[model samples]
Target: MECKATWRRWLLAALMAVSIVSYARPPASAGSDIADAAQAIHTHAGAHRLILLGELHGTREIPELVRLLATRYAAQGPVLLALEMPHREQASLNAYLSSNGDAHARATLRARALWQRADTDHDGRRSEEMLELIEAMRVLRGQGRDVAMLAYDTAADAPRNDANARDRFMAEVVRAAHGALPRGRLLVLGGNVHAMLERPGYAPPQMPVPMGAYLRDLQPVSVRIGAAAGEFWACRQPRPCGALAVDGSPGHTGPQPMPYTFGVMLERMSVARLIGRADDAENRRAVGP
Candidate 1:
């Protein structure tokens, strides 16, 4: 009886050890994965001064990836992080980055029209994750890192339906930013289509020229984000904008080659939190009757 009890105690201890190891392994594995992905990004950034990351707008992963890359690049030298937001928001973005990332500064940034867009038009760019990314840049700058951000999209009042004109305008904005920071590295984040080096044969007539095509002379390394299956926020016209389901190797068009210089495959993706809605809810909760 004494021997049996001792054996049972040993077995229980081994089971608890296994349980502890299993629980601890996932977080470490996740960190490893992120580190590997960052290394891949670093390799690409090393070869090209301008790294264009074309991503699906509404995933939490891409923003985190951008933050990691920005942090790494800032350590080496000056770095510019450009986003697809309207140029009119540049003042607001600059102010937020310059200020202490406090509640008031966050509120001011959220007050912009981009974050308060109608639910039907909130296509994921104004995500909480993106806001967090901006905050991360602020933190980096506060830590004395030479980091800057640019809102390089077309102006809000510009003709929204003119794809080519919009791309040209965006490219010009990026060019000016690059010229201003000749020694600084730039990481331009935009929708996947805008990062294509050439217009795909299957592309619609509206986008005969992509922004990447316009900036090809700079030898920008364009990377397309890929996923096996996941959800992203997008509008399918006729359907309201919301989290949409994606399946079976999203972003891969077989036989016909894509214009991206390289690709980064994410294990899976999840929808990013909408910043406006979340902030509104938090405020309401704070002021409850």
Candidate 2:
């Protein structure tokens, strides 16, 4: 449960990535997959304080897996869900969760103009799969479960000017969440890069440290699980490559080229309803199964 060894951590992440990517089906294989994954998560999460789950935004499996973990852990004690969503949405989420209306949450997203990313790239800002996750969360809370969810991103009052600044701020927010609930287990979820134990910085002139690395530095008890399925978009872009493009040069994106399905990356929960019919069709054709 306690992943003190570097190799053990890597092995866990690799197994999750492999299983999540290769395993297929709707209701059958998911049981074993979820059971195996849930057991791993429970082992670490039960003993440790923080469990970071790496997500490939638009995929359906990752968030369902997260819900599986939350549902599994809710009976034992307090389970706090730390989301990568903007901290600004905290109040709206609270209101939406407290009420039965799903419409308000959708409206809040529209008011923020956080809907579609097609203006920059083909990546969806929101996805239906993610909405399902949000609905699941709301339902869990409504069922009188001890599952609490919130956005642990950025310093509530600070002005983030760069990516690193945002990472640090988000790290602080996570640490704050931990401090707030010392008795509960924290389930942190975010994109692959943000959740990596030894994550490198985003873009050039950035440090090699990831947000997870910062949290690990603060609390070494954290366990990070990375999951991805098939090929998906790598980041936000104006044009659709429908695949990966790596910078082979020194101090760049990668050591080699990796394939992808999205022109954009990391769609938010609202994306399921935020995007237009045309965009959804394009996304489904490009990546969705």
Model 1 misplacement above 4 A: 1-31, 247-258, 277-289
Name the candidate that leads on TM-score.
Answer: 1
Q: lDDT of each prediction vs. the true structure?
A: 0.71, 0.51
lDDT of 1 at 239: 91
Task: Report the Cα lDDT for residue 285, model 2.
Answer: 53
Candidate 2: C-alpha lDDT: 0.51
lDDT of 1 by residue, 1-289 (tens): 1133433332222112101101111111234444556677687557578988888888878888888888888888888888998766777877777776666777788888788776767788877778878877777777677777887786667766755788887787777666666576888999988989899888866655989999999988888776667888877678988887755433442212458877766767788776555454764454232
TM-score of each: 0.81, 0.65
Tens digit of lDDT per residue, candidate 2, span 1-289?
A: 1112432232222112101111122221344555565665576444676766655455455566777777777677777787776665566555555555345454564455344445334343255555556656667665666566666565334664565776765666676667666575788877656665564434345443467767765453333333222333445445552333322112221111211111111111112222433556675454334
Q: In candidate 2, which residue ranges exceed 4 Å CA deviation? A: 1-31, 102-112, 122-125, 155-163, 199-208, 217-229, 236-289
Pull out the clashing pairs in model 1: none
